[model samples]
Each structure stands twice: as structure tokens, then as C-alpha cells.
Target chain A: MDATQLIHPLLALALAPLMAGIVNKTKSAFAGRNGPPVLQPYRDLWRLLHKGAVYSRTTSWILRAGPIVSLAAVVTALAMLPFGGTAAPLSFAGDLIVFAYLFGLVRFLMVAAALDTGSSFEGMGASREVTFSALAEPALLLALAALARMAGSPSLSGLLAGAVANPAVSIPVLLLAAAAVGIVLLAENARIPVDDPNTHLELTMIHEVMILDTSGPDLAFAGYAALLKQWAFAALLVGVLVPWRTGVLWADVALALAAMAAVAVGIGVVESTMARLRLVRVPQLLLAAVACAALAVVLVLR
Target chain B: MDFWVNCLVVLIAMTNLRLLGSSRVVSCVHTVAFQGVLLGVLAIVGASGGLAAHGIVLAAVNIVLKGLVFPWLLMRALRETHLRREVEPAIGFGASMLLGVLLIGICLWIGSRLPLPVGVQASPLLVPAALFTLMVGLFMIVARRKALTQVVGYLSIENGITAFGLGFALKEALLVELGILLDAFMAVFVMGIIIFHISREFDHIDAGELSALKD
Candidate 1:
């Protein structure tokens, strides 16, 4: 692959934690406090990597493999995603489905690993994750499908590239699908209005509780993978909302990166502004996303 | 201009969903008021250059009546009733939102099937959005339990009708549109008075609770 293709993956690896840092900084800024350094996540990952591992007696090979597989899946998914205006390194005609299910695989592995611990809290967390993701998955797919149809291409890169090519036709479609995918990003990443990543209460936790038993390097992997997933999804959103392409590879890549950073700030604002929906009401929010995607589909179909 | 029209349409549709999902009576009123103003702006945006004066006057009347007058009347009625929130719904919020989506889909399908008018420069989304808002208002009136919410729903229906009317402004006269607006205002005024009396007399304005006297 050329340098443009290499930039996407390298950016994913290097800047994923920076997104979490930006989010934390934004949240802290909103609360009027000096937060951790912007490089704090990187430092945390470094610390975790050097620490010793502690495994529960009931844990098996599944528990050990969970973080690695989840991270691997996310990395593979990253390879399939186009960074802003750049085509991904490994895109094919049907890679969009593969890109989406790679997350499903991550979820499956995570749930299995959580179940392997045999902890009641982790089991509850796993159940919550499965229930919510099941609702959110359709929204992601339908939104992508709408874009695919509008772009007249089934592949992720082709849809994104095609959307950017036709601004006048794509803006309305983009507005609807962007909102749908934005909600999916927040829900799937355990952000506000779905599940708060920072809440201390175990009973209310969805994602964090699932990894209660994970510590040291394993916890680090999970955290890093979560950040990468956030970046990947945010990239997808930026790709839709910011359709600007300068035709120069470096300029286009820079614009896309800036747009992705703006998305992170937007997420931070949303998290700061809205409280988590009542658990029962989470389905309603997901349904709204589905409604948005469905609307986009209907709009394009007409 | 088409972009602005679509933006307004999106805002109008959002208000429909907001009304469906909102529990607070005052917030519902505010959302409806916001929707009314959006419809006014949409009318101006949707109109062709030839009808600029008609569009502006219609939009101004819309803003005054639905945005200011109706909201003022409803809020006064709400003050008399001392009802701030609608605690019960005939259908739950989540279900109402889902139903709202279904209504929108059906309306959009119908709208797409209908031919666009010969001379109108309106966005194709206008008709479907108008129909969706209309159905959502009707849905609210049916599904909400409070008398105040019903009033809000009725006002939403008026807003929807106004939006629908905008799509036909080329064929319909300015006088007919004004007459419709005045009629809507009077209906909301009458509804507000009746709601105030019901809440004052019965001490609770729950429409569902009013069915006890059917026998």
C-alpha cells in the first residue's frame, strides 16, 4: 500500500488514546477543573503494560484470549475503515458487512470472557451489553445501507467516497444518517444516554462491570481497544459529515483528522450535558436511532 | 434555498418526535410553539420568488398566532390548572415514539406516490413532513391522558394543517389561509377556556379519568 493507506492505520494506533484524552479534557473543562494531562491515557496504558497479571481461579483460556481477540478484531476493523478521504488498506466490495460484524465478534468475545469469570456482576454486564448492542446493530447497518444505496456502492470506502463526490445529493441523506450513526457511536461505546463509562455504581454499569475481573495488561488491552473502537466509529461519522476532499492526499487526511477531533469534542459535550437514560428508556433511544436510519432509507428510496 | 427548506423540514420532523416522547406539559407546548415557528419559516422558504409578499405575510401571521398567541393562551390555561407535567399517557412514551415513526413512514410513502405540483419550488419532503406532523398531532390527542396535553395536541394539529396548507399556497388565496389561521386561533382559545373550566371544576384535568361519567 502507498503512504496514504499507511496513514490510516498508523493514525488509528497512535491517536486512539488521544481521543479518550480529549474527551476527558473536554469533560473536565466543562466542569471547571484541571483534568489529567492529555497524554494520561497513554501513560495509563504504559503503566498497565508493565504491571503483573492476576487471574481468577475459575477463569480459563477464554478469559486470557478475550482482550487480545477484541483488540485484534478492532484493528482488523480499523484496516477496513477509510480515514476521512483516504481509502482503507483492506476494503473489498462487501467489506462493510465484515467491518460491522468485526465489532459483533468483539462483543461476543467480551461476553464470553466475562462469562468465563463466572461473576454475577460480569454476567449482568454481559447481559446488558448483548441486549443493547442487539438493538443498536440494526441501526448501524440500516444507516450504512441507506448510504450504500445513495452512493450506488455496497463497499464502505466506495459509499463514503461516492457521498463526498456528490455534495448536493448527499447532504440531506448525510444529515439523517449522521444522526443515526452518531447515536450508534454513543450507544456502542458506552457513552452518555446509553451507559456512562465513568459511573461508580456497579448495578447500573454495562461495559465496565463486564470487565470487573480484568486487571493489569489485560485491562490495558481492553481500554486501548475501546479507545480504538471509539476512534473508528468517530471516523465513520466524520467521513459522513465532512465530505470535503481537496484531491491532495495529505490535505484530505489532515482535514479528516481535524473533523474526527471535532467529533470527539462533540461527544464530550453530549456526555457532559445529558444524563444516562433510565435503563428501560435506553431501548427508546436506540429505537429513535432506528427511526432516523429508516427515515434516511425512505428518503433515499424516494 | 432547497437546503434551507430541507433543514426546516428536519427540524419540523424532530418536533413531532419530541412531542411524542416528552412528558412535561410545558415542554410539549414549547416544542409545539417551536414547530409552529419552523413551519412559518418553512412557508417563506418553500414559496417561489413570485409570491414573496404573500409568503412573508403568511409567515408573519403564522409566527404571531401559533408561536406567540396560542402559546400564551395555553400557558395561561396551564397556570390556572396548575398542571406542569403529564404523569400518565394512554400509550407509553417509547411506544408513542415508535408509532410516530410508523406514521411518518406511511405518510412519506403516500407523499412519494403523490405527484409534485406543477409550479411549486418546494422541497419534495414538505408534503410528507406535513402529513407526518398532522398524524403525530392526532396521535398525541389520542394517546395523551391530560386535557392540557390534548390542547397542545390540537394546536399541533393546527400547525400540521398550516404546513400542509403551505404546500398548496399557489392555488389557495391569501384570504382563505388567513381565515383558516383565525379559525384555528379561535378553536385553541375555546379549547383553553374549556380546559381551564374542567381543571377548576374537577381539580384534575386527566381526560382518561373523565370517562367515569359515561354510564
Candidate 2:
């Protein structure tokens, strides 16, 4: 196994919670509020680990198992995702497709667990999530497919590693794909505009409401999984943007980290500046990703 | 491995036939279960000559969940609901079967026309089997009136993909394949519970009756 391959999973696991904390701080700073420290999320996780959970009267064991499954699935996905053009700890030809579907699995569990609670609010969120993600997936796939075609390789690492070697025309397509995926990240991770994580109204929330009944270590696992997902997406975007060079190991790693931070800051800015879109409008936003991805496809094919 | 791939193809064809001919929800669940088990066997066969521990684990999970646990769960639910017979399909059984045959032809034709890339030794049967399964799944989802049947159809499609994945690229990361299987299982599990709840609340399982969402 390559040293870089080993580093990817470690970096992903270590930085995920911090990324969540950073996003919170940035959003707070943008709102002009004295934000909680960047370490707040870690503290929350630690506290939750020691606390006891309260279960819904209607839930089955699946509800309790949701966070455990979510964490496992996300970590599994991270294990397959390549960072900085290096191979993931686990990779195969066409692994990217699997990566997308694994995340789908996480979504499936989260939604099911939410619905298991028999809370109407959670059901509503689950319904919307499935609907939007169904549309979002093809767009995500097509975007990566375009990149794959351009790089002449089907693997995620190969496509992203080769991205920087493309001509100038490819830059626009890459940027557009990044932007599209960035929006998907926000929608998927339950950031602002797509969802307000801070919202008190369960009726208007997406991710948070689904876990209204979760507590203790389960909550910690869920929180960590969410952050891990965000980090994975950011890493993917970083792989797309940062140039790949074998000799520049330190520079590549640095650039990847910076790109990730930039994504967090971007999310914070969006959260601070914009109000959440109406529920119906969320699909429209997802459609934009489809449209942009379609453009990338046309460009690559042309 | 080739024999296993052939078995998967036959099973895919059987699933298509079941979807086209059977109105019984329980039978449809059983057919999907058979497909799932065949797929699990295919995964094991595909991994037999390889050293990927992950792939073996994935195959084991697929066998246990897709083959045994899921089917058992669906069957239990079927018994509880006592809705065994499908009354009328959107398309007649004979016509649907004919369409299924035509779909297999299309799959075969498409599979033959595509040139296999170098260093890839995918079985000729793999692609068609996948396409056939996918089409059958889509057909079941559309033709069936009951929401539970539609969910089963979706699971069948996932199984088809898994079979194809094993045949074409099982040597790649097994994590994603495992994840996909886990996701499908959980999705079906959740959908099954929801279907039960919906049936209990509405006193019917037809998608047409759940028109409360429409404006």
C-alpha cells in the first residue's frame, strides 16, 4: 500500500469533525454573532457520547441502528474516495459509481430511521430528501462521467488526478462541475439555503428534524457521519481543482487542505447571506446541477 | 465464473417473466429473492479467483440479506397483509411477457454491438442480463398498482446492477458494492414498513389511492 493511500483515510477521519466545527464558526461569524469556538462540535460529540438516548415510542431497532450504520457507511465511502489524485485505500475500476450509491445507502438508512420514529415532520423531511436526491444523482454521475471521459479513465482518482493536465477549455467545465457539486453538498449536507440546520421549526427542516428523537452516542455518530460526508465531498472538489504532481507531495496536500477550508468558508458565507429556499424550490436548485452537468457533458463530447 | 454468470442471466430472465406474468405480490417478492440469491452466488464465484477480502465479505452480506433476510421480511409482511393475489395489471400478462421478450432481444443486441475494452474479460452474458433485469424492474414498478410491488421492483433493479457489477468489476472496491447492497436492503426495509403503515392507514396498498399528495 502506498503511503499517500494510507494517509487519505486518516486525514479524512481526523479532519471531518474539525470541518463541521469550522463551518459552524464561519456561519456564526457571518451572522455577526459571537460564534461558538471551532472546537464546539467536538465537545458536543464528547458530551453526547456520555448521555443517554430517548427513543420514540413508535421506533424499532432500525431507528437506533441508523447512526451506527450511517457512520460505518460514510467511513466505508471515505475509504474508497481518492484524495489529491492518490488512490484511496480501496479502489477499483468504476468505483466512483459505487461511491455515489454508498452515499445513497447512507441516505436510505437515515431516511428510514427518520420515518421509523413515526413523526410526521421526519417523514416530510425524508420524502423531500429522497425526491431531491433522485434528481441530484444523475447530475452528479454525469459530471464525474464527463471528467472520466476527459481523463480517459473511469476511476475517481484517475479522472480527478488528470483534471489539471487538461487544456484551458476544460477549466470552465471543471469549475462548473465543482459549483454544481458544491450546491449538491449544501443540499446533501443540510447546509443553509437548502436547509437551515439551526432552524427550531421541525416543519421546515431537513436533516435535523429526522434526528429529533436521537441522543447520546447515536447522535454523536450521526453528527460525525454528516461531517464526514461534507469532508468527502470537499475532498472530491479539491481533487478536481488542485493540480496533480507526484514530486509536489507537500504542496498537493497543502492545496487539498486549503481547498477544503475554502469550501467550508463558502458554505458559511452562503448560510450567513441567504435564507433557505422554499421546499419546492429545492428541486429547482438540484435541476440547475443537472443542467450545469449536462453542459459539461456537451462540452466534453464536443 | 462463467457458469455463475449464466445462472445469473437465467435468473434475470425468470424475474422478468415473473414481473410480466405474476399478479401475486408474494410471488413477485419470491422471484426477487431468487434473483438476489443468484446474484450473491455470482458475487462469490466472481471473487473466487481473486484475493479481495472485501469482495468476499460483500458476497456474504448479499447472500444473507438479499437472499434470506429481505425475502423473509417481505414474505412475513405479505402474510400479515393477506394480500396475495394481484387483481389486474396495468398491462395484461401475455402482452407484458411479449414485451419482456422483446426487451431481452434489445439487451442482447445492445450487448453484442458494444466492443469490450482491452484487459477486460467480462462475460458476453453479463450486459444483457443486467439490461434485462433493469427493464423488468422498471416494468414491475410501472405496471404494478401496489406500492409494495413497486418497491420490490426497485430491489430487483438493484440486484440486477449488483449481478452486473460482480461480473464486470467485482475486483474493484468491494466497499461500494457492499454499500450499495446495504443501501438497497435498508431502502427496501424502510419502504416495506412505510407500505405497511400506508396500507394500515388507508386500508389499501394501491398507489392510485394515495392521491392525497396531489393538488
Candidate 3:
């Protein structure tokens, strides 16, 4: 691969933390308060990395391995994502399946680490995370499948590129898939109407609860990985929503970055305006996403 | 013309799905009203000429009665009765939706097999769309417990039949079609009045409770 193919992944890693900051600032703006700077997440990650590591007495080797493995999985997934019609460094047939399960691997590792801590609170978080993610997985896969059918490509790069390549045949199908993936992005990232990431209470948390015990560099790794995953999903959404491909590398890259920011603002608006769904209702929301995807598949087939 | 008809068909299907999934009574009313409006458009579109005078009259009556008059009457009844919630259904939303999909599949299979009158200019999807909407309307009436929702279901069934009529009955005698429309209007108007009285007496509008009438 040429050095230019490296740009998308590198940009994703460097800019991931900024998404958290944008969401925070947007939430703060809606609440009529001066929020942390847009660079606050990056600053926080830096601070965490400088601190020494901490380990629990009851934990085994898995505890130490969780953050690294999860982050590594996210990075691997990022390698296949095409930002704004630009192909990834690694593109292959059936890479979409690998892309999905890499995040699943991240969740599995996180849940395993949380369970290893032997705390009831962490276990509760793990259970909620697993249940919700299991429901969300079908939405993600079905949406991808619909896009694959529309584009006639089973791989991530090809699918994203193929989606924009022909707008006439794909617009309706793309619309349905975009909505489904949008819900998946919110649910997978622990956003509002799924699970509130910033809830002050531990009793109602899903993702934050799982990482409560980790500290220092490992915490930094976990935090960064979460942000990168958000960026990756947001990129997928942007590719679907904004299908403009100017052919020039810089224009496409710039448009992709701009679309990513727009998506962040959109998420913030959603978080501000809507109350989180009741725990029982989250499955219904995911089911709605599945229905959208399923309907898209039906339309494409018809 | 074909594209517009397909769009209308899709819009009709979506409203049926929303009606099946919606728990709130107001939104269900809105969905039924929207279906009514679409039926008016379909009537005009199904006309053989540029604008058949009879089709124009039918469209106007449908838009007025189904879209405006019935919803207004229902909302006024809702306000006076103060029975707004329909949170629980005899059949849950998810199961209803699955059954809706199955019903549509059945409609499509049956619609394709049934012979259509020769020289009809309408899309092939007309039969399936009409049958699907009809089944969903019946499903709503049978599955929902609230009297208002059942009435909405009844209106939905009327909308389905009107849709079917747009395809088959438009070529026949206009008096027969006009009578059908008048009958539906009168039935809903009476149902609205009865719903108000029932709510005033029983303090709830659950149709299941009407079984107590046998004693």
C-alpha cells in the first residue's frame, strides 16, 4: 500500500477523541452552560496516558489484556473503512463480516474484563451491554447486507464506493440502510435513547459501568478505542448520507471530514432533544432498525 | 403515472405498518386520515380519462369525509370522552407487525393468482395493495381493545374497500359506489356518537367490555 492509503486510518486515530469533545460541547450548549473545550477529550486521554497503571488484586491476565486487545480490534476494523469514497488500506471480499465482528470482539473483551473484576455492579453492566449489543448486531449486519445487495458488492470499501457510484438505483435502498446504521451507531456508542454514556448514577449505566475499575494508561486505551470506534461508525454513516465523490483525493477527504463533524452535531442534537429509551424499550428501537433494514432488503429485491 | 402510483402504494403500506405498530390513539387517527387522503389521490389516478366526472366527485367526498370530517368528529369525541391512552393491545405490537408482514405476503400471492378484468389500465400492485390494507384494517379491529381504535380500524377497512373499488368498481354504476361511501360515512358518524355515550356510561371504551351486554 502507498503512503496515501495510510491517510484515512491515521486521520481517524488522531481525530477520534475530538468526537467526544464535540458531543460534550453540543450537550453543554443545549443545557446553556459553557462546556469543556472541543479538545477536552484529547487532553483527558493525554493525562491518562501519563499516569501509572493500576490493577485489581482479584483480576487475572485478562484484565491487563482487555484494553489493548479491544483497541487493536478497532484499529483493525478501521483499516477496511472507506471514508468518502476513498478506499481503505485493507480491502477484501467478506471484509464487512470481519469489520462487524471486530467490534464484537471489543465488546466480548470488555465484558470479559468486567466479569473478571468480580463486582456485581460490573456484572450488571456487562449483562446490559451484551443483551443490547446482541439485538443491535442484526441491525448492523442486515443494513450492510442491504447496501451490499444494492451495490452488488459484499465488501466494505466496495459497498461504500458502490453506494455512491450509482445514486438512481440506490437512493431508496441507501436511505433505508442509512437510518438503520444511524440507530446502530447510537446504540453501539452508548449514546442517548440507547444508553446514556454520561449518566451520573452507576445503577443505570451500560458501557461506562464496565470500565469503572480500570485506571491510568489502560483507561486511556479504553477511552481512545471507544472514540475511534465512534469515528469508524460515523464514517460509515457519512459515506452513506453524503455520496458526493469529486474524484480529487483532497476534496473527497475534506468533504468526509466535514460530514463527520456534521454527524457529531446531529448526534448532539438527538441527545439533547430526546430522553433515553426505557431499558425494555431499547430492544424495540433496535427492532425498528432491523425492520428498516429488512424493508430495505425487500425493496431492493423487489 | 406508474411511478406516482408506486409511490402511493409504498406510502399506503407504510401507513398500514405504522397503524399496526402505533400505541397512541391520536397518531393512529392521523395515520388513518393520511390513508384516507391517499385513497382520494388513488381514485383520481385510477380514472381512465383525464378526470372522470364521477371519479372527481368520489375523490372530493373521500377527501372530505375520510380525511377531514371523520377525524374531526373522532377528535371531538376523544376530547369529550377523555379516553386518550391505548398503551396495551390484545395483540402486542411486535406480533401484530409480524402478522402484518405475513398478511401482506398472502395478499401478494393471492393478488397475483386472481384474474384481473381485461383492459384495466391500473398497476398490477393494485390488487395486493388493496387486499393488504383490508387485512390490516381487520387485524387492527380484532386485535386492538379500545373502541376508538376499532372505529379507526373500521374506517381503515372502508379505506381498503374504497381502494379496491378504485380498481374494480369505478367502471360499474356510480350510484352503487356513492351508496357505499354514504353508508360508511353514516356508520362512522353513528359510531362516534355511540363511543361518546359508551365512555360517559362505562368510564372506559374497551370494546372487550361490550361482552357484558349479553346479560
Which candidate ranks first by TM-score, i.e. highest? Answer: 1
lDDT of 1 at A38: 90
True A-B contacts kept by model 1: 0.21
Q: After superposition, how far is residue B110 of candidate 3 from its true place, in Å?
A: 4.1
lDDT of 2 by residue, B1-215 (tens): 45555444554555566566665677777778878877767766656457477766777788788878988877776666666466357876656765775676677777778776676666666777787788888888888788878888798789778866766563565767877877887897888787788778777778777777666
Rank by DockQ (best first): 1, 3, 2
Better TM-score candidate (1, 2): 1
Record all residue pairs in model 2 with backbone atoms less than 3 Å apart, i.e. clashing.
A92-B172, B23-B86
Q: Which ranges of candidate 1 are over 4 A from the true structure?
A: A162-169, B115-118
Number of residue pairs clashing in candidate 3, backbone atoms closer than 3 angstroms, sequence gap of 3 or more or interchain:
0
Worst 10 residues of 1 chain A by lDDT: A162-171
TM-score of structure candidate 3: 0.87
Best by lDDT: 1
TM-score of each: 0.95, 0.58, 0.87
What fraction of the reference interface contacts is present in each model, in order? 0.21, 0.00, 0.00
lDDT per residue, candidate 3, B1-215, as tens digits? 65566557766876887788887899999999999999899877767668878888888988998899999988988888899566458998877876776676678778879888787666666777788889888998899988899998998888888888788745464677788889988998899999988897799888888888864
Each model's C-alpha lDDT? 0.87, 0.77, 0.85
Please give the distance, in angstroms, between residue A278's alpha carbon in candidate 2 and its true position after superposition. Answer: 1.2
**Could you tell me the TM-score of candidate 1?**
0.95
Candidate 3 structure quality by residue, lDDT tens digits, A1-302: 67777889999998998888898899999999999999999999999999998898999988888999999999999999988656799999999999999999999999999999999999999999999999889989988988888788879988888445544346656777888899999999999999898896888999999998899999999999999999999999998887778889898999999999999999999999999988987887777677667766766665
lDDT of 3 at B185: 84
